[model samples]
Target chain A: MTENSLQVSSIEFSYGRTRALNGVSLNVEAGRFVALVGANGAGKTTLFSIVTGLYAAHAGDVSIMGHNLRAETLKALGKMGVVFQRTTLDMDLTILQNLRYAAELHGLSRKDARERISEGMKLNSLSDLGKRKVAGLSGGQRRRVELCRALLHKPALLLLDEPTVGLDMSSRAGFVEHVRSLCKQYNTGVLWATHLMDEVNHDDDIYVMARGEIIAQGRVSDLLAAHSVDNVTDLYNLITEDNKNVVESGA
Target chain B: MSWLAALRCLRGVITREGLRFINQRGRFFSALVRPLVWLFIFAAGFRSVLGVSIIPPYETYVLYSEYITPGLLGMIMLFNGMQSSLSMVYDREMGSMRVLLTSPLPRWFLLFSKLLAGVVVAVIQVYVFLLVAWFWDIRPPVMGYILVVPALVLGGLMLGSLGLLLSSLVKQLENFAGVMNFVIFPMFFASSALYPLWRMLESSVVLWWICTLNPFTYVVELVRFALYGRIHWLALVVVVVCGVLFLGAAVIGYDPLRGFLARKDGGPRAG
Candidate 1:
């Protein structure tokens, strides 16, 4: 029951014949960003599903804020916020309505929910868009709304899976910066999963998955130095070798 | 979860459902229209030949509309239940079902909350139909209206649980339409909803058995008696047992939790 932001150990998950994740383990401390990079079917979403309690692991343990996800699913998941790859926001509802639903789901009091919604909206540059419909927002603004909802209850850990997949170049960078700055200020631990290399930073910790295993782990620079590669792509190429599913971003 | 948190989560689930119903104006109107057409257009003609008499709930001969009223109520809940199930499948695919699952509440309770929310929506729709049917002189004693509430609650729970089960099993939207055709239509037509079991037996003993075996028949019969200030003990038991069975299956069918643990193996894993 130690207050580790996230501690996944010896996790194994399989969907019939295909093992999605195998003996994968990682940790994130408060206020740190860790990028999980892998190709499309590399099990990033499966691992996130297991960690967020969306899917049960065949054999493993996931701890969030000292709470074991299996035995204390409610407490563990309650302490974690997630942005799934798909859009969860209602296109017809106002942003406030969407955020309020999350607030209530997390057991926030009326006053606390109100305060957080207001404060979060302002912090996320969503104050003016409170009454706006999600359908009208740009791709990036929509992602921001999802991010805002994830933060409404002030979870200890934030998990975002392929969050910037559809955004334009500038929008993608803006989202990465937005998450980094806000999550840092709140001292929230982050496990951001993506295939895009540019969305990651040299200073950030990294975990590269291939064929359901953690092929590499360390800071982006450490991974590059260890593999003797100058770039993320080259590092991925060297590590994965003939494994067809490699990192996507040329950046 | 504390009582207050649990209550708050339930309220949120119901409110979200209410909002979705309101936003879909076409669906709302279509639900109302479907029952009205079945009661007035398709059913009105078949009334003369129904030959219903001394049905336990009907001490004396009753008009076709009066005999048909409770069945229509059952039909409304049945379709509403399936509609809500369709929405669940759609939500699991493209919506915030994942977000809702992240709630710290026990997974079973969250699903029950969803079932209850769906029941609430169905009951409202049922009442609206009844109110409209009143204009056509379709109702029972003043007390009948009051007594029917609990019956509708039970009936809604049973049918909604069945729908929940279907939602979990149906992989794609295409399969759901088949369920509606195979499950819903057969359950409605083969049961005592449109006609009595005796009439079905008179026509075909095999059809009668099929009607007797359908859980929806018990649901309809339960509503039939309860609407008239009585309870059919057999129907009551069958409905209760079927409700429990369907809900249990649905909770297990849901993949978010230990549902997968039920299987030994076999299904392609997708990212």
Candidate 2:
């Protein structure tokens, strides 16, 4: 089996005449946190979609846990769990029902699902809220439930797309800490897509995207040293500025 | 996937649909109300103008209400079928469809499970309509009531499959309402649902040909024969075949390689 949890080779995708992804490549290894940082339209969601098998890339290969997505799609997909940027919970169903449905979708038996749901609730401190409908939950609470649903199947590679968009500062911190702990506890590889600089932890790997291309990627300390910057914020601004200058000069 | 896992997935989907159906009272009522309005108001007005000769299944003359009741049952399934598809479009826009598609099960099985869930809801609405029509003095024979179960299921599956096909083709929610109008109106009007095929032929040869070609006609006829405790084998064959074909097309339309819904380019990416 491969060491990396996910390996996306140089992949390109286009919509009609305009390109959505331009030869992007990235990887997430076991027990590591990889932050994909990009402004809007930086192709974060598109890349996530490609990895999750929602859209096939026009060019390139994506493998999850050593299984090729195209040839062994079921096996490849079975190795991962995803929480999309948008809320996917059924608003009409209770929180427990939503989690159970997700477990069943992953082909977990009833007994296994019950055990996992309970274990997940305890892990996230989400007990006692199980009976509430998702429609009634606050934005942050709903986001936590989504996270719980994703973990019920205990997937090796967890893909989360902007999972903390509407969360408050304290809630955001809590969510981040919770995910970090889970990654370490299970040795699960995580690909977290976000635009918020605060969510990227120290020592984490970073991929900076602009206009659908991955402009820079490396460990945070290495990226800072390479860019002659002291912090990720300054390094990010410098990289975007450099790209802007090159674009302006070329045009 | 193992057989047990596939069955579990199917059960999850079906149970969710069932819960939604029970929770939404307005949706349940609306599914029945449309057919009831046609059965009571429209059929009453048309009764004086339309006289029925004793057909093979009929020992004596039948009133317009009695004749159109089976058709109204088909109408219930037809509208509910489209409603399920409309929800599918909404689901795609809201990102739940992505969750559904990402499941490890085969794409065809996932889609077919969804279609079957819709059919199950439609079948329930159909039986409720028959019960109401029964109270209105339009009851079928006792044996006929038992026989119509399979007919209504087949009709529901057929209409729901068409809904799946339409949902895959209609790209946006704003565009789906117009497409539904185009599809549902023509299907109801051109079929033998509202009037007999002979009546359609008397109006125009072209109209008759269209009514004959419409798959909804077979669905209505299949239900009608079952209500009279008989079988229309040709109509049965046509309905089943069209159901399978539409479902097949739907599965293809959802394929990630070249599916209409799978076109991520040019469209704003939904989270």
Candidate 3:
């Protein structure tokens, strides 16, 4: 509402009788890298779905740069990029072809798409692997290709759902560094969902979610200190354990 | 999006589909072989048993193999269209379909682009089958043969739209086998594909009416008539009407809000 890159106000989403998201609200300012940390079934993926226009919220509004999700999904989505949790690359396509396809889908011209894809692949450090098919790439390489595809259009807001779930430590670090560099250099707002506390830097903004709600959100260092924990993992455990105790006591 | 942007996206989808087909060479060979087997083996076996009549669009008594070439072409398109749709379901399961669907383009245009790509592949298969039919001495009139391109394209579009409609409703690829057995077979056989509608009428007028109602029957009839340098008004009407109807249904079936294609249970889980 205040010129934030993303604003989800009291969004509610349900799958049949099970409420996946319950009156969830969050906002990400422009050019900020916000990490959403939650355990499985914490509605992290569901929240991403709503934000990317994959699923409509039952009872709330999602706006991107002051444009309503429903009213300007194409325009809003055009300015946003997403890397879904699952592998979205065509296995048979070469890395370059996949990025070119994504660029074309975003309405880039053939020449422009090719140029942008080359730049994106370079940015993701995948220029050498352009001619290689996605099926032939390693998991980490594939994830990097997905990232390059997401960045081909130079979107204002980038949403990544568990982008580094199956990577080695070095690969994970490399990916995190690339993401950090993107945020710093391009002024691109990023909403990254992950459960790995080690990926959370002390300076990064963090949102800890549980049972479809944001239980805590602030700078990682600030939240950890507020919870009297030495690190993010300790802080996460304390918050989740406390929530579980509250739920059990209520029951 | 502008029309140029839509066209670019459509071209991208078609290019991707082409690359996929090219990469799966074995599948392409097998798709071509299946129709050839029906044309050579099955038709040869039934040539004498299925007595030939002076079927219109046929000047004299033609061999069963020759008579069934266009039908077999239609069959090729039909099967390939369904196969493309089947791949779509598999892609959804594998998470690739979501990538395509979530693109910034208009959802309907994205769907239409996919349908067009399927049709392009189907047309290629049909043409290859036609080449083999010629090798077997089953050639149509030259002009009519040229016209078959557009006819096959239209038929492919109609069948591809039906495939899209089915893909949206079917949640799993395993359930699609039943569709091939029930829907595909009946649609291919009940039509004027293997036999003329008049031949079907001798068995039952009701069956004749059903064939008349079938859109595939129109496609077959259109192909049959066009192959002989003749055009059937009724067949044209059927193809145009049914093609538009099926494509409209497919577009609606994929609508973000109202369509089942965009709404399914189970969000993507981290893997």
Best by DockQ: 2
Q: Report how far off residue A64 is in candidate 3 (Å).
A: 2.2
Segments of candidate 3 deviating more than 4 angstroms: B261-263, B269-271
Q: What is candidate 1's local distance difference test score?
A: 0.84
Q: Which stretches of candidate 1 lie over 4 Å from their true place?
A: A1-3, A228-230, A242-251, B255-257, B260-271
Q: Which prediction has more favorable DockQ, 2 or 3?
A: 2
Report the C-alpha lDDT of model 1 over B1-271, residue by residue, as the tens digit. 6989888888888888888788888887888898899889766887786657887988899877778788888988899889988888877777577888788888778888888898898888888898999898886777988888888888898899999999888877777999989888888888888888888898899999999999989988988898889999999999889999999988888755567322424221333
**Candidate 3 chain A lowest-lDDT run of ten:** A1-10
Per prediction, fnat is 0.58, 0.56, 0.45
Which lDDT value does model 2 have at B222?
94
Task: Give DockQ: model 3.
Answer: 0.57
Which candidate number maximizes TM-score? 2
For residue B249, model 3's alpha carbon misses the true position, in angstroms, by: 3.0
* A1-251 per-residue lDDT for model 2 (tens digits): 43899999989988777788889999899989999998888899989989999888899999998999999999998889898898999999899988888888888999999999999998877898999999999988898898898888888999999999888999998998899899989989999998888888668999999988999898988888887878777888899899989989999
Q: Candidate 2 on B170-229: residue-level lDDT in tens?
A: 888898999999999999989988778888788899999999999999999999999889
Evaluate every candidate with DockQ and list the scores: 0.53, 0.63, 0.57
Task: Check candidate 1 and list the clashing pairs.
Answer: none
Top candidate (lDDT): 2
